[model samples]
Target: IDLETYIYWSGDIGRQFAEALAERARAAVKVHVLIDWIGSRKVDSRDLAMMREAGVEVEKYNPLVWFNLARLNHRDHRKLLIVDGEIGFIGGAGLADIWQGNADAPNHWRDTQFRLEGPAVGQMQAAFMDNWTKTTGRVLDNEDYFPELRPAGDHYAQVFFSSPRDGTETVRLMYLLAIAAAQKNIRLSASYFVPGALTTEELVDASKRGVNVEIIVPGAKTDVPIARYASRSKWGPLLKAGIKIYEYEPTMYHCKVMIVDDVWVTVGSANFDNRSFRLNDEANLNVYSAEFAAEQARAFEEDKTSAKLISYKEWKNRGLCTKLLERILAPFRSQL
Candidate 1:
């Protein structure tokens, strides 16, 4: 329920979904709503009021306290929606009013989510149930909460959850393992470029070893200017190591995707930044099918046409004052 993972689909799309979901709920579709207190603090009160009146059981995960710094860092960064517990939506996408635009509508905020209908739905529900227990301090063993979900589509999938709470090195190690398993090329597009040292080193080393590694990030303006500048400082290392870099010329790029050797693709709210890996509670899907990887790779190739390549020569010429600033923040990347 953090504000960052909201779905933006205004106009007819927004009105239609609101009516549809409300009707289904009224007809006895069990609804389980979970929001992060810290992230959703700025969320409008009117929406919560409406959901409450509609009988949707809404609860906030980890309402932040000034003293619990550790608790505050571990946010429920996952944005998931399961309709009928059969059809599930997971990724950075949220069900907030506006999520759809006309196809090729040039949506500024690029995002990705998979409409999953399989055994994975049960796993998704279980993940939510675990979080629900952690925050609510009560186990939810009710069968109604977790329906006997079955696969309605022909797709093989797995749920990969990440967080500091899970382990000290799982997310970081998992990322590197995915990279190591790649055979051809890697395409990564993220909102923030900052990363853990091992990941930062792995990316450069991958390119140096002749792997086709390409990174697409925000050009100059984005939701977080500090992160943009922080990324610029590291471009020199990545470029020298032979990794190609590009800046999306259009609206702020925010999609976090990794397509590797046409086998695995990582899609979720987890940015390739330090905070996402070491701090926040993140949920992502590591799809192992070649077909799914191809579709995602096609989208990356299409985006490449619009993004501008940032050459190493251009970065070296930036004034010393700005370069100094990026260097100052680069060391503290993990804390961001």
Candidate 2:
């Protein structure tokens, strides 16, 4: 198990998850957990002590060390749960109270997680082990974690990951390549949508070439208003080029998904922003099956019903105060 945020709250969803892991550990399941140090700041040390006493091996990724200050900004934002080399789960949801419930209340955030049981599970395990070895300096290379898997379905899928150590721009390059190859339509759902100049240009060009492009982003219920401001600053060209953008209205929208041509789909931790593409370690599952893509596209359309579209005229004639905020935060777009 690897997560960015693993908050521990008493008598809630967080408690339920913590106790489950502890129970498994007490049963001699050989559980190993990895969580980000900064992201888990809300975690109680008592819970960690309980799990440790139960025989769970837990480690924090990139703890504050004087010599490691250079890489402090780069975090392990990947969310992965691989069980016995057979089942794997990946997505943007973290183990916290905010991610609980069915998005029925404002406190319950909207998110998505995908479960897998196929040949691609091996790759997902490897993605987890990549950081595990780096953090613990011990390789978990055995049949318990790398058992042979058979084809569970007919979908052609690939689980890929990117980190600052391997390359800074691999996730960005993957998104650009998929966007450039789109010939029919693009349905993008981004929690944070701060696209740089080149990505903005590509979307505008795709719109010009008659590809139906639409994006969904967080509106007033965002966790990072500065990111939303920076994202809006770059949307003038896209809106002018006839690309439709929508803002979700209910609660915090924390889904990261992109579907192109109704046949190719990518979903996971990486958002459509510089922080995810260049600064943090991210993972995504790309599925090349029309059947699966069609299901996801239908879900995207369902989500659109809860969103309100932003017109170019409205964006152009916005209030001066809002425009001022965008300009003030424009220089820090990369950091957002």
Candidate 3:
């Protein structure tokens, strides 16, 4: 199994997984891990040493140094797990205690993780190798990493990967094209809901055209208050165009998913914010299957049960302090 995570914070959950992976390595199971240096700063050196003692192949992504200071803003924010080049997992959930407990608990994030099978797993593995090669300068092209895969499901999926160094924002362009082509409805669940001007305009236009456009975003329980405010500041334009906005009330909503017309579904790490679109490296899976889209649509409906619909009247009647905060933080939306 090959795993990549952004944050591996020090905690019982982190230690437990590290120990489990070490046990697998001791049993002659091939285990390789890649973690971001900045994101996993809290991981103790002793823990890494123990993994190395167990013969687990581990590497850090882009260690911070004076020479690489300029690349600090670019982060490998992808979470992937590929098992024997057959099964794959990807999404926003990281390896930390925050994701272990109930979402209702304080500091416990509500996120989504996905499992992929069939030929799409190969693309997921390739995405992981793309970063692995850049970080370690070692190309992994063995049959174990890229085995022949057969169709295990009735769906067509495409993996879209984006990075700042790629000279183009592929993930962002994917979202733009999907939203632009949406016909019946567009259901989006965004942990961070700051969309660019063109994207926002397209969404509003979709709503104006009588397409059911709804978005689920974080509420008061969000960890990043400034980002929440920035997201709220952009709600006016969307609401005026008859777009429906809902905030999940049970916990911090950390899922990045989108479904269009009950036939197209996207699930992965890229959020609707500018940071994900322009700065961070992200990977998303676009599935073209009515059955899969129906499943995701059901999840969206279940989430809506815990969400509070934000009406245009309510947004207009917000308190003065709230409006001022949104205005104050709007300028920094790009950075957030």
Candidate 4:
């Protein structure tokens, strides 16, 4: 299991999950856990000791150091879970208390996660091992971790594992290509939505070409208010191009999903922001399945019912304070 954040181990959900993993370790399961060092800074030392005592191999990615300042910003933001190399899970939810309940209450995040069982599981496991080896300096190659996989579903899927070390924005390029090829409709659900200039222009152009483009983002309740401000700062062009934007009203919306033309569905931890594209190690599952896309589209529609639409006129008439705040934060858009 690869978790971006694994803090609050004493909480109800966290404790139960930790206990389950420890039990599995005790049962002779080959358990390996990798967590981001900065994201899980608050994770109790005792928790790590417990897991290690149970024979679970645990490692932290990129521990903080003054000499490695240049690499501090790059984080392993991917969330993955693979069991016996037959099943895999990936998405935006982290192993923390904030992801426990529904999004109706404060601090309870709205997130999305998907399970896969098939050849794709191998890809997900390989992605995990790529980071696990880098962190622990131990290569994992065994039938227990890379078992023979068979077709488990009819859906066609491809895993896009991206990192800053690749010297290219692979995930961002994928989004741009998908947006360019969209014919009818494009629906996106992003948490941090400070998109770059090229992506913004592409989205605007897509909206101009008679495509029904809609985006669901977090509202004033977002945890990163600065990121939300930065995101809203550039909504003018998209709004003018007839793109409809909705803000989830209940809580922090942490889902990163995109559905194009009701056929292509992409979901995972890749947010529509520069940090995700250029700094963090992200993974997304691009699926070509009308059935899955329909399900995701239905969920988007339901989320819209709880969202508040932003009109062009209303956005244009924003107060001076808000505009000034946006200007003050514009330069930091890339880091958001």
Candidate 1 lDDT (Cα, whole model)? 0.70
What is the per-residue lDDT of model 1 for residues 139-221, given as tens digits with 9 covering 90 to 100?
Answer: 65556656776666555777666667767645566778877776679999787778656787888777767789988887754
Q: For this target, which candidate reaches the highest lDDT against the unseen true structure?
A: 3
Question: For candidate 4, what is the TM-score?
Answer: 0.97
- For every model shown, what is its TM-score relative to the native structure? 0.88, 0.97, 0.96, 0.97
Off by over 4 Å in 1: 1-23, 66-69, 95-107, 149-154
How displaced is residue 234 in candidate 4, in Å?
0.6
**Which digits, one per residue and each the tens of the lDDT, describe model 4 over residues 103-210?**
868879999999889998888888888788878889888898888988898999977688888687888999999999999999999999987889999999998889
| Pick by TM-score: 3 or 4, better one | 4
**Where's the lowest-lDDT run of ten residues in candidate 4?**
1-10
User: How many pairs of residues collide in each model?
Assistant: 4, 0, 0, 0
Candidate 2 stretches greater than 4 Å from native: 1-11
Q: Which has the better TM-score: candidate 1, or candidate 4? A: 4
